[model samples]
Target chain A: MPGETFKEYVDSFSYGSRTDLFFKWLKGAAEADAEDYIQSLLQELGEVSDTGDLSKFFEMTYEAQLAANSPPGEDPRWKYEDAPFTPLSKPLSEMRVGLITSSGHYVEGEPHAPPELSDYTQEEGTKHIGEYGRAKPFLSAVPIDLPQEKLGVHQPGYDIRAAQKDRNTVMPIDRMKEMADQGVIGEFASMAYSFIGLTSQMRLTREDAPQWAERVKDEGWEAAVLVPV
Target chain B: MSVGHISRAFETAGTPTVIIQSNVYRGRVVVMKPARVVYTKHLMGRPMSAPFDTERQTHVLREALKMLETATEPETSVILPDAYRIAPK
Candidate 1:
């Protein structure tokens, strides 16, 4: 009974903001079909009743599982060969984190980015004040990540690096690796993480998400530092 | 994991994972376990909550390995196990 009651107030992510997501997942929870899988998610959130903060709920759930020695119910692998994967188990402080953002184009569910869309810096998506000033600090994107004072000049030049003549020449993946080699991390994760910058369409987000995830998998990284700008 | 099929692929691969909406505290990363998948409404290319009414799109993620503990899980979990992709236009 108590367990059921606790379930009543367990909030996950957006709290009441995205209750639709939970319901969507619930519609197909049983089948695990794209539909069933979605419904199961809805059922999970619907349980978060009027009792508490969803974010705290997140912390509490992890704390409880850790205390009880419970499993998060994931599939396990018996045959890992190359290198033993080290879980992301740092004190949360000393992690080699990364960031990404847009606030410009490439919206899904609506219309994708135009053939020639500029980055947030060039676009008039926000006023002279810049949305980054408010939420920018929270994200971990490339150029925009510079300190608050560097606002206009904070462009990450990711496009230039990525568009260079050679694949290895583009981007700062090597810089990340160099940091890793220098004992800059308890354990340097293999995968680098990212997010959609400015697009507002859920559909566009859905399309962009898997690629970032794949990067994490490809790099064999132990953990992800998702910022969602 | 497969490009679109993140949930199934990760769980089957046995990779331990965690998913959070915001970075939360600076450097205070939250690690969850036994997760076949760890979805987040969080977007890609960027790593923080986006603009207003963006749908957050109700994102979901999958995981392969558990959090290396034999502990009991919580009555309230942050993520619902199921997540969906947008229908084709």
Candidate 2:
């Protein structure tokens, strides 16, 4: 009866399940009451739900949430009339390749910390959302050889637990190194660049991205693989 | 997406880039129009592959890197045949 009551209470929310409510909470939606109710229900049930199911729920609801929250009559997605083309001038085996990831990864003791939204209550999160996009875009250079144990991720946009377990899930630094050693590609760039994926696209396009491009060029990287999470 | 914008910036600056993106954003990726893209059916947080699936991860990386040499023009995109599903225990 308790389990049935808990399930019924969870299904009462607009999103129709506790998992959806959990994702709404994760995304900083103003759902404090729902969050509290879900937590209490979990406590009452005394059962730990499968995280894979939670992740699946988040993926299913993510686009709908974005569509619902977007301002009317405006397409928030980016579009370009033409894509820039820069052909590889040299053989793959002879070029220095680098990696750039929107994984929000940083080595332990690094100066950067991606935005932390999970600690905020719903009211505080609502206030934080306004300023979230304004946060300056930054790139952290992670060394190619850094141990996996030292890697950390802080992107607020998605569930970061997989990346926490194995950063190669996002960055693939180990895979890159293996390729470089095997000559599947040229030398690996000394550093792999990373940034938080949930920042203002306008600032990134107009300002920070160009600078980062310059940094990539200046570093003599001929090609790059961008892994977006 | 930030990766799309950054890839454009990099390519504009004479550095070619290949984007390994999740297929869920294929529509968006087409509009954003980076130099090259390889769409995989992996989950959002694990673009390369599922965690600890080293062989698949390496394969994804290698395939994306190959596009750097093989792509002739901008907006060259491919959807990888690979898919990720959790194995039943």
| Poorest stretch of ten by lDDT in candidate 1 chain A | A161-170
TM-scores of all predicted structures: 0.28, 0.76
lDDT of 1 by residue, A169-229 (tens): 1122333344445554334453332322333223332443444445555655444322221
Best by DockQ: 2
TM-score quality measure for candidate 1? 0.28
**What is the C-alpha local distance difference test score of candidate 2?**
0.73
Q: Please, what is the whole-model Cα lDDT of each candidate in the order they appear?
A: 0.28, 0.73
Regions of model 2 farther than 4 Å from truth: A1-77, A114-129, B86-89
Q: Candidate 2 DockQ score?
A: 0.57
Best by lDDT: 2
lDDT of 2 by residue, A67-152 (tens): 32332333446867887999989899999999999987877777444345435432343345445466777578899989988876
